[model samples]
Target: MTTPASHLMTSLRSGNATAPRLTWYGPDSERVELSGRVLDNWVAKTSNLLQDELDAAPGMRLKLDLPAHWKSMVWALAAWQVGLETVLDGADADFLVTAATDPVEGRYDAVIAVALPALAMRWPGTLPAGWVDYAAEVRSHGDVFMAHAEPDPAACAIRAGGGGVHSQAGLLEGFALPHEDGARIHLAAGDGLEGALAGALGAWQRDGSVVLTAPEVELTDHLLATERIHGN
Candidate 1:
């Protein structure tokens, strides 16, 4: 059975796979771009890591403690692909994905520390014992994802900060922001992770793309013209 997550991935990889799907601008003039195929590959690897290494399965809650960066977006997509409920808030979760330098342990079953830099092959600093270094381990996982079991459409996909929930089937339709078809939308990091995710989903669903900028990055006229951004 094809779940919503799987279907979305399929759509993402269908046409113009080499076209830029997500572009990110961060502090210090950092720029990163991911094509549709590349984004799918990252999601696939992360999903495999979650399933094979972390033993994640449908109904398990995975909390995201990272910022609204491109890597954070990939992690969310991977969790959804593996049928894990992504918790944006709340304390009780089986797995915690964070970029924090010193993440508090003993709260979640597993803590995965992520490196925010686009080209980071491993964590920059020493990770606490027992914590998983995402950059170090994720590359060793398979580039393709195969679900151990199909996800239920009625299963919760996102747990919002306000304690609201969106089902897997309803996630895109209910939360995605409005956008014109094939438009290149600019997403501001100040909108937060949830808003960014929603906007990205909306754009992808409409065969559009997103240019996401970090909070510290300014949206200048030059940048907009260079990226060919249609709207924000």
Candidate 2:
């Protein structure tokens, strides 16, 4: 077995090749954060496919266009096996097609994305023409996925539910503050405008949940959900 020093040397020598990470995910997840959950799953799949990708091609990179709801610990490890970078390509296909235009972009011949069917339909050309259906493949994959890279970081989440959400004006003020200066924030106000803070604008390490009214982030209520009770 490799000793601690051996492992440390191995990691230090080729850290870039073995360091894992979650490049993208959703914002303001109430519990474990649905977006973070998907990220975790993706990491798992990538890790499982890492050796496979490596055996097929020694030096290659994987570029991902992940939806807001895609996060998996597995995806990160798998990336380290090769080199995977995460990118957020809005919620549309028009942009995605354009993203694969250049040679560097072309290098990302493979793709991992959610809503593959919808995306496939939107593509001007054909499905799997030069892309790998990430979500679809993941759904078909086994539940148990292993890792080959080191832990980048675990994701934590906080959300302000709609129970306290009320209408005064016509906008969504969101329920949580973006947190301290270094806080993670994803600002999104979708559908039900009565009151909803779509996401955070910073990273995913922010704490507590704060809910504002319809027109102002300042004029809102306060709430915190615990795992046992206050479940979403």
Candidate 3:
């Protein structure tokens, strides 16, 4: 099978346009739903920024030290599309994508910070020198990305350390969580990137939507029913 990142694009191209692909529930009851087409637009713009602006290419390492917000998924998909090895908090990387709340002192060639709050639009304060505001700059990039070259599935796509490397193919191999098509998988933000990856990839590969939640928010039956959730 093709990588989930690739399959996701195929799904979008094949007319999975208006369906909710990801629904994020943030702290303070913030909610956002992105359809496949909208999600693709974000990914494409992000990919364009990564490739065109940052000079990202195959074999470069891009660290994602972001929270389990919807934008994190966009960054991940964009990195994968460019064939950058996406790692979790791996200090040694060509690029580091994180939230504005994270420490900005790093040696990365490029730093992209995202503001996780809903409706925040842009980073509130002046960022450290050389850091890019994702929300602000991403909008300027084109909505379509044409990679200079094809990604190699056998190459490392994600590295969480522990002497293991998840290739593009491996990461795409859904985390084995059970759910039917269109199931809304709920994940807690406190679960972090690893937890989000497990649930998101699994649900996404199975033609299901994900509902990421903040730990503080209660997942009531009403919320589940209202969100059309099928799993947690």
Candidate 4:
């Protein structure tokens, strides 16, 4: 299997276009982009962190709270960089608040959220804080991108849902495949489609591309009501 770095370098050399990647902002700001130099630096920093994690703990689960925007590609890639299974919860911060408390899905390391969507974030850690700015930290890292670890698919990835978390065989089945046409995006369940930077967008960004479903407004509204009623 070709490494992500080699694949990214090939795409960059070819000058491909990619979907935008998203990052959660402060409590007030909406999602923001982490492309260009910002993206380079993130890839550089997170790449090292991921390698360190793999070195310390070979099979640890990683949880990310991301939205469906082009910018989300960065975090997804970063997660894959460390071989962490990015739990795909098609809900927002409000939804996570309940998931975290529930007996089944409550053991996440961290979740990513932005603006109003962050209504689900009552949890805190290095990933998400009760009252903190993640973007500022990304900026503090600077413009140099660095890393040495390669993508290891043999590692575990768990997709958590209401009943219980399941093995991410769907991932091993192949989410991105190299084709004569180019990098192809594959998604089985509808949940994998959001903010997945695939096809043209991914090629340009030198990031993994995605073919995801559009966002759902009703779901977000439902999370809000649940949070309001439950007092999250």
Candidate 5:
């Protein structure tokens, strides 16, 4: 039915397939690049885990309480693919996903902890009861995900920052994306999740990629020129 995920999948397959879909730079000068297919693979595995194992379906609410890292972005797309609402807080959620060690403060149906480091393969410490390690469990799921029902784009997709809601269709509607010139977007302020989301969606819509920097990574002219980055 041409949901955002279906449309994005089509673009991923038919567009400039060789270009990088996302690139992440860490505070320690670590770099990671993901092609469209590779990004789709992550999304698929995440979707399978949320849908098949967790029994998450349409109308479910999931709290994305993690940082604005690559995995968090992947989980957002995965939740949208399975028609789950991605909320910023744990209020009225079926699941709360975070990178923090202590999530006992929140009451949720379940908790999933993600280890955010690039090389860290698993959660560092012991997880609380009923909590799942996203990295450890997600890899065991199939690489391809098939949704049981098509997502309604008009349905509420994200709830962020003190009661703001955005639908899947609205997220893309009137989105003015730059040309698909393989531009590398440099984000300066990493505070707003909604803004980051809009930028990512715009980049993907135009077959461009994003260069995300954490708060600690300083943006410099030399770094930008060396990276051949277009703009922020």
Candidate 6:
């Protein structure tokens, strides 16, 4: 079956691949932009890591404990591409991805620590024992993803906290926020990871772009004009 992840990736890599697909504004005057091709590469590499290194497969659950950052978005896409169910409600999961400096051990089969900085090559400080360093490890993975096992469309895709569950095939239909085609949408980090992911899915599905602002970063008029934002 053509899983939602595979379909979405195909769309992302098609036509005008150099167009900016995701742009992020963060604290300390940080700005990161990723074109469609680049975004797809990141997602593919992360998916490879999940599938090859962590042995992630369909029907398994992976909890994303990070905030609404670009890296978090990549993780979500990677998990889905690997056919792992994304758990947003802090539910018990087979794997855990977090930015926490000292994540509790043995709770999950594997733990991945993510660094929020766009240019970070590795975790700033000493990495917790038994934890995978995303920045340090992801680059070694393949840039193209080929699923070893097909995903079940009828399986649960997202376990949204208090928002209920969505099947793999119905994830985008259920959670994607409506937007105009090719629109540049702005997202606030305060909306949480779930909201950001949903908004991103909505925008990308429409061949649009997303501009996400961190909590401390104000969405100024200059930013809106520069990013050519058409909707929120």
lDDT of 1 by residue, 11-95 (tens): 8887888999999999889999999999999999999999999999988999999889999999999998888899887568999
**Candidate-wise lDDT, in order:** 0.89, 0.30, 0.79, 0.37, 0.76, 0.89
Ranking by TM-score: 6, 1, 3, 5, 4, 2
- State the lDDT of candidate 3 residue by residue for 104-173, as single tens digits: 5658789888888868777989987778888788889998888887788788887653666678766766
**Per-model TM against the reference:** 0.96, 0.35, 0.90, 0.45, 0.90, 0.97
Model with the higher lDDT, candidate 3 or 4: 3
TM-score of predicted model 3? 0.90
lDDT of 1 at 228: 97
Model 2: which ten-residue window has the lowest total lDDT? 223-232
lDDT of each residue in 7-111, candidate 5, tens digit only: 776576556776777777776887777788888888889999998888888878888887777878789888888888888764778888888876367577778
Q: Which candidate number would show the highest TM-score if scored against the true structure?
A: 6
Q: Give the higher-TM-score candidate: 1 or 6.
A: 6
Cα-lDDT of candidate 6? 0.89
Clashes of 1: 0
Which is better, 3 or 5, measured by TM-score? 3
Evaluate model 5: give its TM-score: 0.90
Pairs in steric clash, model 5: none
Q: Please provide, for model 6 over 1-232, each residue's C-alpha lDDT reduced to its tens digit, 9 standing for 90 to 100.
A: 9777778887888788999999999999999999988999999999999999999999999999899999899999888888889988757999999998764744799999998999999999997788899999999999999999998999989977676788889878887778888989999998999999999999899889999999999888988888899964
RMSD of each: 1.3, 14.6, 2.3, 10.9, 2.3, 1.2
User: Compared with the true structure, what per-residue lDDT tens digits does model 4 show for residues 110-193?
Assistant: 333332233333234333343223332333443333344434545444443443332323342234333323332422222442
Position 64, candidate 3: lDDT: 86
